[model samples]
Target: MSQTVDRALSILPLLAQGPADLGQVAERLGVHKSTALRLLRTLHEHGLVYRQQDQRYRLGARLFALAQEAVENLDVREIAHPHLVELNQNCGHTVHLAVYEENEVLYIDKVESRYPVRMYSRIGKPVAITVAAVAKLLLADLSEAERRSVADKLDYPMYTPRSTPGAAAFLKELAAVREQGWATDLGGHEESINCVGAPIRGADGRVVAAMSVSAPNVVVTAEELLTLLPLVRRTADTISREYSGSNRPKKV
Candidate 1:
């Protein structure tokens, strides 16, 4: 990249951290005051930076508008679908992509297994929040207070004997899931179904979605399914990179 363009682009993040005066900007960029002024002026003309009455430079309104527009237009499902398909093909099991919204974790996309014993779930269906791997991964990213509040309000149905039984247990599960950065459902939702999941993060490192791979115990034992954790995590990370515009997604 050209030095001029790189220097101009660097100002946006600096100003985002906080406004800075001309000398501070120039010092940070390791450039002379005149060169820094030129860069800042160019950014100002493009409405990417603002000059305050206090003489500090800050990110401009147009930059914010563009950021919001880009975020609003980003479809996590669209970006993750092909990756999900690739995962299913590799593992020969059901793969799911889910997101938390309005206090619910819902499946936003799924790729079915090639085998006959497929998991019965649909797009937009709210997950078994107390026991699903995808739900655990999504909810684990919530702040402690948010997770506690959500845990307290949810019904702890005995989807299976292994399912999370109450708020305390569910909270404990979420805490572990958060610390470990991954989650699993070992016959918790259904007696024979097992799942492993990983969180898909945004550029800011917050969980924006989760992806999972699942199969019946007959097809893949819980231990065998657990072995897929690394693959699931790799796929999730790839989707995250592509969705967050950090790096191009690679072949799984």
Candidate 2:
């Protein structure tokens, strides 16, 4: 609906065909040359567009990076779904796969517990960024500056007495999670819910996504949940290996 956004988005597909000069972009957008230049400058600043030696604009390296990330996320979900199911089958607990995107962490896949007792959650739902185990694992991998930035912006709602109290505490928790290479939410998001989570790393050893196994206190004590950390980490490692192509069968 916004003309600036519409024009900026139009430039991407236009440039996708090939590089385009300022005059060409202006003509295609039906806007003044200065207007097109301003739009291109905005896009360039965001690394979505590049100005070449010929003074023509083309898709920037960040575009390819974003595209690759999208592809990797799709592959992660595809590769991790069966693993999640298997973990749920073995443990009879709810399994969740989540990724951080646009400053929000959302569940991309979930396997319900086989047991009649189950946790309530939905795929595509944004997680409790400050308290969820998967959210912690994902955010913990971010740079210290980024972590502080995000933590400063979040509301530390006391979902439970165990919930992280504020930015300082959340940042501290993230540090511990990053150092330990796994995280947990014990009565953090909900009074009765507890979760243990591990990071799924990419080929470069960056956290690409996180997966968790969750159960309620009524079903499993905190100590019982802690006992499953090894299993959860193993499952997360398996997903990471497969997603990174490290688990590919060796040639016979």
* lDDT digits (tens) for residues 85-136 of candidate 2: 9999988999999999878998988999887888889887789999999999
Residue pairs in candidate 1 whose N, alpha carbon or C atoms collide under 3 angstroms: none
lDDT of 2 at 105: 97
What TM-score, to 2 decimals, does candidate 2 have?
0.71
The local lDDT score (0 to 100) that residue 107 gets in candidate 1 is 85
Root-mean-square deviation per candidate: 14.7, 10.4
- Candidate 2 lDDT at 15 equals 96
lDDT per prediction?
0.90, 0.92
Flag regions of model 1 displaced more than 4 Å: 1-74, 246-252
Measured with C-alpha atoms, the lDDT of residue 207 in candidate 1 is: 92
The most accurate candidate by TM-score is 2
Name the regions of candidate 2 deviating beyond 4 angstroms. 1-73, 246-252
